[model samples]
Target chain A: MYSSVSKGFALLVLVLMNCIMFSAKAANGITVSTEINFSAQPQQCVTLHQGRDCFATILIQWQRPTSQTICLFHVNKKQATSKKQLMCWPESKAGQANIEFESSDNLTYQLRTQLDDRLLAETEIIVSWLHKNTRRRRWRLF
Target chain B: MFTKPINPNIINRLFIYSIVAIAFFIAATTHASPEEQSLTTHGNTPITKDAFEWQFMLDMALVNSPVMLTDVEQTELWDYVQLGLLFDISYKGFFLRTNSRRSSTILGGEELGYQITVQKDWQLDVILKAYIEGFDPIEILDDQNKDIPELVGLNNREYTSGIALRYSRYFENAIFYIDIASARASENEQGHSATGIIIDSFYSYLIPYRNWDIYLGAGLTYYEKALMDYYIGINADEVSSARPFHIADSTFRAQLEVYAQYPLSQSWSFNAGITQSFYSNSIKRSPIIDKNKLTQLMVGVLYVF
Candidate 1:
């Protein structure tokens, strides 16, 4: 069982590395981003004392290989006719929103780069929830 | 001006208000956690996410220091390489991590154990740790109190296992650490067993300037008498002919460490750290002690994935 698991792990790592490499290259030329992150998280209490008076947050951040203007929009099935643009060209690098369950129900998000009013590249993005955000622990030595 | 009478009730109410206010202040100033990051995917192939993370790291350094924490007098500098593997599997807020540290020395500094992380952000952890304690042979009665024999038969190294509680927090540029452990002798066939509690606290500050990072840290450590005696104390049976029955009490120690790193790129960095330690009087008064200060230096490169 362990052997098979190890093999699977190796394969997964190879794929992840390839994806990262491709992403880097794509960001440089005509690709959408060098790196990007779109996520949803429960609003966390930033204090020692904990409480459940928390909501949810949607955040998006991206980097360009070169300075190119991109536009991003957030829409939801509940408001099918509304096109809530989160960012415009140049300023569309990052955006965040505090939301509720109804706000995220069937939400649609997309990123596109434009050149002289012409769309050059476009991609739909899906934001997934992470169990928690991890902070790097300090290294210790004996 | 007329002086008002002291009202204890107002002071009491004011104190409660201040505490609540401070709690709110602390909560407001805290930073967002990054332990679990939500991922955004392009309309392409689905990315597979794993539940476990495994990393292999090697730390090689040149150090001229004592053979052991208690053996402070050894001034000979030796170069050593330390290789380590860190395997962490985390889900939700719970995690289990197994660490392997391998080194080359007569007094092995290798450790193999698993630590259960019950909580990360609040900085609480329960750990089981095992390590080798090294020692040097005691020389003949150099500072004779009267009539004492030269040391003959003595143990050189021992293994110890312990349950430790660790608390850590990284606030802005400084990190705080506190670890307390209760340990007992393990795998000792010579009827040499000891148990005691150990407490240590460290405060370290990080300074990042462009591509260079510097760190300065200070810590305090306390050891129970049982633990100190087993390492530095002399036994009754071993105190004959030319040796005297000597004992060591609980000891305290202080340390200062300075480290710096330069990131050459995203995957590679060069780092160096030096540390100095001062021993307590209880340990200094031990019969075999020759030096009170111990210094260590390490320089190496690190790679990350």
Candidate 2:
């Protein structure tokens, strides 16, 4: 009876650990938020060579449990001074915006409450490349 | 620009230096032979999706050049348009490419060739080339549109083809080429004797500013007895008092050229270049050759499809 009880306890611990791991995995692309949920359609942009500019059209969507005045912002995390408001919805439960992004680095989009400027949810767009920026050998045009 | 004729002593010194450079390259290649064997074992990189490609381009140029056929000293302005096609196909390490038109600044004017082997920065190729163009007797006209007496009775020397082996080294901002060929003149009624060896070498460097590519190049060409004789020598059958029979000896020619190119868009570009050639004594002394030197200037545009 004592051994059986110990085994049961171990199984219970294993189940709790798995639950915590899966919850973290679910939060990988999303920010835990009580007021709003936000996401972008394409999570990444790829270019031909490193250091080249990547252009992409991003669709940002957000929803909340109740109506609230919220604003959407485009942010460049590398440059702290680069944060611009894209659009704002007045007393709406959900909102969507299309943005044209041209950048060489990753960028972030933030959804915040306009009332007190409190952060609610955020998502990121990553940049990737196929080839390094080494000198390419031109076969002909010499 | 050559203000005065080059002295024979300077020519001899330059020739010696060129020989030394050639020897050095041969020796270096021999020393690297072992590495080449190992590299061959690795095979080529995996093929990519865009490995086969082709392009067609139309080129038109306005040219100003000195006429080299008669004793009369004259320069003429002319324009021409040429259709060019380039096909590039590569599988593994082997490649075949068309050379319908090369850069005006390059020493080798145009040739069709294929790569034989490549090791690191060095590549070897075999090409079919023509270094000289033939002219008809009627093509040589005086200012009055009359056939010049000097060329009236002479037979046409048809354009010839040669087989050449070329070795090249490439760098980030510079390139070097060396070619050795066995050339023969085309059969014609002139009964010309033609079969000889030719050697040519060129070195070019690029200087880029903004979106422009500016190139400066220098080259040397050596012509052996049979090739030189066929072009400049007056055959015994056609010998006259006015055109005495002449035997041409081996000769050398030196060239310097500069070219600049600017891209207007993805498929259009502008180019301009100037080339000057200095002939050696054997070539200058030919009765048909009026000037010991020649200069050509050209400006052109190209459209790619």
Candidate 3:
């Protein structure tokens, strides 16, 4: 009877230690941090001459934790139009991801990121025109 | 024999009347149309026709200007200012614009200022501003006696007069603006005199959401050394820790800022931005600058008349 009681006590201690270690590991597992960097490559400011095509390339960088898949969707906030959809898997060696959009219109855009159908982060970029009154129209009453 | 002693009752009546007149003037100026108020406070932006074009903003900022540094070799400096304000405003094409602010004190002193801008399409926009600043000098401590020395001299009051000229253009969902401005500073007896010229080239894109706008741009400012030092803390290190006087060489500054404005209503909005100054080498390497960091966060309100 004494031996059996001792054995039972040792089993309980081992189980409690394992539970604590497992809980500690679970608490620190799988955190995802996302960052978005907007770059107007080759140009800091886009100058749109009146009645001319002002072209610029927008480079986007999405950084995530190692070994996570990130899906990116971009939409023009002003025109309510979608630009492109990008899906990427970032490995430990390739800790960075990238996407690009070519735009000629003056608009603001939103970049959204998701992981396994879970929303991760969002950010915005604003592209402006150079000249005053390039494409503006006066309101006319009908 | 000719002059009679002024009556005490008459003097009191005159004082009361003066107070009432001043109060009336302030109240009238503070209550401006939404369009006129927004233009003055945040410079000028393109107006829209949707009857809902407007901006709202909140800002917190820190500024250091070394206007006075007596010893160029020693790292003593003076002149620092900080700001916090909430602003709101509205605009419609070129017809009407208004701006207003509720300001707070952080580093330097307390101030409240407002402006109005009126435009007629792409042709012309006129701006008028009235501002007042109160300052308390930063004090430095002495090692031996535990006494503090005032870094800023007397003359802690500032009155500002400002005017601006604006030209505008419109794109698909954005309005572009170019503004030329001049502001004069009236300082108290101990304060330094300053005149500033500001050239602002701004471009703002209207978001699909109602009353949301984003802007990015750069500015070039040329100011007298005294003005620059007083505002930018150029030679703060040369001032003596025991005394309050320092001299600074004239300086020029250029900065880049990216900001967004959101309007909560016709009369109120929020604005926030990040500004980084590209300082002149002389100013950047000055011994008086402790950290030599050039980044600032600007948050403020947009109040439309």
Candidate 4:
């Protein structure tokens, strides 16, 4: 019984270890071939403080579309109201855009390959007004 | 105007146990927002019963004093982290994945289990896993409380695979849970070659206010003879002048817990819990055992992405 249990435990631990290791090291390797980095500053809000303006600064960045001009679409998921607008066409291989919303909600953005609105890549960021706990601290006595 | 008052009886019990002892011992750790998942919704339905949903929780607790003092007993505080991940895929009431969702209040144990939900009422779980000792005897560096004779003869524990069955349910204002497990001894480990059984059950009520949330609970634990000896027994060879041979039989443990979380923002919250556990005479009689009751507390922040 002991031997069998030991073997089983070892096997189970091995499987869990594999899951953890793979999850840590898998698909995160993004190729330079395609990418879109979208982020928002003040990603969240918790107070009526932080200066009354409770909104987030949205950023949309992607590799410049080589074949044609690309347009950007901001999909508001909070209220289900999505809008499309021309962002940037590739004058160069790299492109960047910064936009801000005065409200707080979840937002998604898509980059299109051409003015015809061929979708290429999409990303999202959320700006919230919920109260947030403070950051944690770690110290070592030894 | 929203106000939720904690039951007076619970407050009295919390006071009786001096649960506020760890109220000031806050640690710097963070759990994400979903940890506040006191509400579960299915499809387009309004707030309904708790169902298996996608959940990711990371809970960290800094215990000020080590309770299970089996090894290197000089440590003043210990850190514990419990991570849970559950993803459910279902369509038309048929769950494609094993509903692996549970509320975590037990110290720490791993269960490779599957759940069966009963009409969104009771949840049952069956688990099979390689067994490891639940009692942890840690080794701390630069030890301070070294030379304590009662901390001697502490050996690494042995374990084998085990089977556990758990049942739990969420009520209107409280959650009820229970679990039982039987263990098989590892063949190579000598003192632990006996089979054992354990039973535990708890009930906790939730009180939600505008910004504060409280969970008060109480529970009982029973360790069968084989299980008690595996953990609390002292071998003849390990017996010394300071540590005598101690044999244990079935034992019982009673526990009271109070946990609270204050959300400062939608993304950040402060969480804390104090648990006091009392042991039976069988365990308290061990020569190496010094405390009959142990109290642990943890307070930290939470960050949700």
- Which candidate leads the pack in lDDT? 2
Where is model 2 more than 4 Å wrong at Cα? A1-142, B1-51, B72-110, B142-144
Put down candidate 4 lDDT per residue, B1-305, tens digits, no spaces.
00001112223322422222122111101221222223334653332222222212243444333444433332333223322222222111222221111112111222345544333556666655433333322222224345645545455344444677868776766777777878665543344466877676777776654335677878887777876676667878768887888887788878788877665665456777787778775676777565667666566664432
Model 3: per-residue lDDT, tens digit, A1-142?
1122343465456445535544432221211233323222322223222223333444544453344555555655556555556554434212233334344443333333334455544333333332222233211000
Cα distance off (Å), candidate 1, residue B265: 3.8
lDDT of every predicted structure (CA atoms) = 0.47, 0.59, 0.37, 0.46
Q: Write the residue-wise lDDT of candidate 4 on A72-97 in tens digits.
A: 77777656656656467554455676
Question: What's the best-to-worst order under TM-score?
Answer: 2, 1, 4, 3
Candidate 3: C-alpha lDDT: 0.37
Steric overlap count per candidate: 12, 0, 64, 14
lDDT of 2 by residue, B3-81 (tens): 1111122334335433543444344435432211223334563222112222334556565545566554332322122
Tell me how far the alpha carbon of residue B240 in candidate 4 is from the true structure, in angstroms, after superposition.
1.4
Alpha-carbon TM-score of each model against the true structure:
0.52, 0.57, 0.37, 0.50
What TM-score does structure 3 among the candidates reach?
0.37
Tens digits of per-residue lDDT, candidate 1, B119-192, equal 33335566555532433243212222232223346543354556778776767778787778887754344678
Highest-scoring model, TM-score: 2
